[model samples]
Target: MMTFWYIFVMAGVTYLIRMIPFSFFTKRIKSVMLRSFLYYIPYAVLAAMTIPAIFYSTGHFLTALGGTIVALVLAYFRLPLIVVALAASGSAFLLSFFV
Candidate 1:
């Protein structure tokens, strides 16, 4: 079936992606710029993947924006995770009623 071939190709690609970096980058990277870039890659990737989901999660833009703002403020203040989450959800729910 086509699905089987697709799966096989996907697995091979995934394996090659993982294998290439390990096989090719065996030596220590001496470039400071490259190291810094690599260090921030995870955070950059996380934001890239997460920001769109956050904005689109709620059906309404205002509700999602309200929730995101609350979350950001609470997170900036270093509030507990549960508190931030609940407050964001509550704010979004309240905004949904208004907007």
Candidate 2:
């Protein structure tokens, strides 16, 4: 089936992405700027991926905004992850009734 081929191709691509860096970058990277860039790449990628999901998860923009605001405030206060997550979800759930 086409689905099987798609999965096979995706798996190969993913493997190549991980393998290529390991295969070619066997020596220690000496450039300070390159090392710093590599260090921040994951966080940059994570924010890019997570920010949109946060705003769109509630289906309604207002509700999502309400939740995101609560989450950001809680996170800024250095609250526990569980507390932040629950407060965000609770805010979104409560906002859903009004929006």
Candidate 3:
């Protein structure tokens, strides 16, 4: 069926995109700028994806805002990531009850 072909093509494309960098980039990157850019790409991508969702993921804006603040404070103190995530969600859950 057409749907099967579409999915097959998509999977192949996705696999190749992920595989090409590993096959070609066997040497260590020598450019400091390029290495720095690569190092921060994941964080930048995560922030871009997460920040907008943070504001809109809850029923009320204040609850989400409370969670964001909790997350920021936890991150500032360099707490474990799981602790920060759970505390943020807990703050949002508790705030939602009162909002």
Best by TM-score: 3
Candidate 2: worst 10 consecutive residues by lDDT? 49-58
Give candidate 1's root-mean-square deviation (CA, Å): 3.0
lDDT of 3 by residue, 23-99 (tens): 98899989999999999999999999998888887878899999999999999999999999999999999999898
Colliding pairs, model 2: none
Q: Residue 15 in candidate 3 has what lDDT?
A: 95
The models' CA-based lDDT, in order, is 0.93, 0.94, 0.94
Model 3 regions more than 4 Å off: none
Per-residue lDDT of candidate 1, residues 1-99 (tens digit): 999999999999999999999899889889999999999999999899878899888889889999999999999999999999999889999999898
As a TM-score, model 1 comes out at 0.66
Which is the better candidate, 1 or 2, if ranked by lDDT? 2
Q: For model 2, how does the per-residue alpha-carbon lDDT over 29-74 read when each residue is reduced to its tens digit?
A: 8999999999999999989988888788988999999999999999
lDDT of 2 at 11: 100
lDDT of 2: 0.94
Ten contiguous residues with the weakest lDDT in model 1: 49-58
Judged by whole-model lDDT over C-alpha atoms, candidate 1 comes out at 0.93
Task: Pull out the clashing pairs in model 1.
Answer: none
Could you tell me the lDDT of residue 63 within candidate 3?
96
